[model samples]
Target: MTGPSIVVAGGGSAGHIEPALAFADAVRRLRPDARVTALGTERGLDTTLIPARGYPLELIPPVPLPRKPSGDLLRLPGRVRGAVARVREVLSGVDADAVVGFGGYVALPAYLGARGRVPVVVHEANARAGLANKVGARFAEAVAVAVAGSGLPGEQVVGMPLRRSITGLDRVALRAEARAFFRLPPRGPVLLVFGGSQGARTLNTAVAEALPGLVRAGVAVLHAHGRGGQAAPPAPGYVPLPYIERMDLAYAAADAVLGRCGMTTVAEVTAVGLPAVYVPLPHGNGEQALNAAPVVAAGGGVLVEDAELTGERALAELLPLLTDPRRLAAMGAAARASGHADADERLARLVLDIVYRHNLESARGAVGSDDRATEVLRPDPRVWRQQ
Candidate 1:
């Protein structure tokens, strides 16, 4: 009488939540009858994002895996045991037919709870697999990755699951409207800047330092300085926001991007075909730089280390590219070429395949016609260029 019950577990940061949301979006689009509930924790950004997107969010206590051994580490076993029990409750309540994870704090419990209970599908967005995903992949029915070599079993290279807005963007067609939305000139080059969801002080400082030079060159700037993190001085053709809700429009308005190399950011920027200057965070296990490597290798972007991305350095590097139309267009094309716009559909189909036992022919009939089948997973090759 009802479609399969699906639970997606990816909580904590935007990097984890956004991809999970995108995959949930795809699942709904492909199978409207299915019930998709996002498994999250109260402490995560999911509390805001999941509800806003109209998905049911089930919250649980966060079980943080402490890196260094300490009191928290001592309590790890009991904490994990309690968290896994809570996850089992959530999964049972939802009658989850399958567990799809994007790898975050909640994923560990989800993986443990769903063990031998329901089919598990793990999608890792980073070049390097995380501890949670590394565990989940042990028994995951299907393991997918944006970039290969994540060391997850049966890891197939299926790009990041991006929202339809980005996957379906027509930047050139909406450039004027997008620029107008930000109260900027419709014809000049615009550069979009942002760090991760929380904003980056390093980027804010660098972009602030480069603002005067950018303004003088008639370059418009739209900076999402992250919530509660802004120090950029006011200048002509410059706009700063606490956060960016309409990244689709932001991509349309910008000729190029200057931002962090988080997997979600890289996926969205490239999915929309925007040339970028990716500054990988200097911390962590060096996965951020790995996220940006392929694009840089394909000549679609420039990768800079966080320590080296000064305002003076930003101005010197970005100035020439913003001014050069042909080169920028070329870079955008290359970025698009390396990106997988159909990842959402492909992942959705994969989910259907395992959960519902959907075969190729039945899947096509359920998703599209014979004609549409040939091209359902192929992104339109048209590159969006700045007006």
Candidate 2:
């Protein structure tokens, strides 16, 4: 099959953008001649990250649907119509064969614009479906999810698409180099702590207060405090940085992880076979806790409430795990078993399958077989919606 021109859409945070980029990379790998265009909002991190990764990103105005009565709510219809119109223009200009949506403000427009004209594939990274994905799924030919029971129509558990750097990481081989890079001790179990890209104050404070106990237990600390946050005054065995550019290296150097259970973070840590203690964010729709449930159930990690994650609580729980090599190894093995390293390839295959099916239907339609073409071209009722 000739490479199909595809539009991949999503952005805002690394969670959505990362998966979209990973999937795009996979498509290119499968079809070197593939022309992949990314659609994202200008307000998102994609303005920088997408171009840096060498993919062309077309900017769209964000169509944020206000949930409550307000001025933005009143303007919602106009905003959505404008965004969708702009997206449709881009799709036609690019001659897109299909669209893959990874659920964000940008995804709704992309999905709406491409619904009837192209094969639409929606990927939901969270265990719980987001609002954008919920609407996208209504018209999507295929719906992929990171976890089971996402409540989206036609949902298939294709796992999360991880970057090549992370999927190809060799933690065992790079252990020494990683330790040296992070200025960690040559010998001693390392505990890696991070929240998201913005850093969680709860995590930082808890870990800081617990550092003395962790250090006394011969556990080295490598903390990524996010932007503007610093490590609690420098102490022996504690290394803190505002952000970690190379997370693969940090994973390689760590014996266990302490952080929030965002889908990307949990997926990456488990993919690399790292035991973790996940603290789901206290706010939002409670999806973070849901994201961590499977990992904790699989014995790959532990889940702690945000309120319970104090320095004292951390020491009480993590000290024993860090000290016991056998237990740590067992947890790592469980994590590796539970993680899906081939998720990128799996999702790519799904997208290609949809494209191929659409092509076959288009060819049949061109042959003038009205009944056959209609049957082939009709949208599946399970996914199709009037709006």
Candidate 3:
């Protein structure tokens, strides 16, 4: 295990990449000499993200597959084969001991790319399993999950890993610093809105339409409209930016939050103890909603059906909550209770254990027995690929 090299793979969005990077940092902490490299498709945010994090990144080709059976199904086998070949080629060049997938189309190739004896570990960040993670799970020595009930094999609830910067901040100090950083009135209640890494158009539109009403009611706003969301500034109390460079500031100053229910979003809000109004993406299965359910059930935040969230409707719900300071305080406390602060370390330990065990087993005569041996938790497969 000396100077062990690990490949952290999966990226298309910041959600997947951030967790991978966090785990890499944890690996460095555990073994300062450990070499970590990131593998992702050229198309994902990894191009800028991986490099910015100061990791060596290898570009792979795209692996696009429909969630459902489609004409794309015909290309799956060939695409997976090609991706596997490319992954193998990458592994050949690196001194890798294990490959870790963070759940995405890119993870499929990452797991498939491994040659004999190298263990593969995966992290699934939702209650419902993702397709790439599902396939990769079959090859995994262990699969770490953010939620308890995922259908993947060998799954353990590790909580969603967050960056050290986020994990280390003190909430009270952060809030004061955040308000100052955003130039908001120190005494006013702040409402934060975002639509994940790539803004949600529907969410953006509704929030924009509701902005004036929010401002009139005396609420201060720090909104991350995303590149896809509205770019125009709404009014005086509201600040609309293409993106928020310092998420710590955005999270710190917020009394209430409005955003999508992606796993990373849910984790960060919970970690920061920010009350939220989660609008799940409507199209794919109910994965986003599922991701937010435990928090809503715990009274940490309210869940709004995307289709039913009209501008008037959102205003009616949000205004009352924002106007009530006591209620916001209660919700904020509940949100903080949902965070597992040591998630990154827990997941990193799980991965390292799996890698060590798999390697040890291979050194013994236990070869093929470890390949398909996974801790299977029965999840409804019908729901795994939906969202």
Candidate 2 lDDT over residue span 11-108, tens digit each: 77777899999999988887666789999887869898999999998988898756668999888778899999999999999999999999888898
lDDT for residue 101 in candidate 3, whole number 0-100: 90
Q: Candidate 2: lDDT over CA atoms?
A: 0.87
List ranges where model 2 is wrong by over 4 Å: 367-387
What do the candidate models score in CA lDDT, each in turn? 0.86, 0.87, 0.80
Cα displacement (angstroms), candidate 1, residue 180, comes to 1.1
* Residues 1-387, model 3: lDDT tens digits: 245678988788887899999999987776666688899888869899999999999888778868778988888889888888878877878868899899887888888887354888889998898888888888778888887788998788888889977777666787777888888778677888888656878777787788788888888888787876674355776777778889887877888988899888898889878789999999877889988888898889999998888778779878989999899889888887876667888877666666555544554444344333322211222121212
Candidate 1 root-mean-square deviation in Å: 7.0
TM-score of each: 0.88, 0.93, 0.86
**Model 3, which residues run further than 4 Å from truth?**
68-72, 231-234, 359-387
How accurate locally is residue 360 in candidate 3, as Cα lDDT from 0 to 100? 48
Query: For model 1, what is the C-alpha lDDT against the true structure?
Result: 0.86
- Between candidates 1 and 2, the one scoring higher on TM-score is 2
Each model's number of backbone clashes?
0, 0, 2
Over all chains combined, what TM-score does candidate 1 have?
A: 0.88
Task: Report the lDDT of model 3 for residue 357.
Answer: 55
Candidate 3 overall lDDT versus native: 0.80
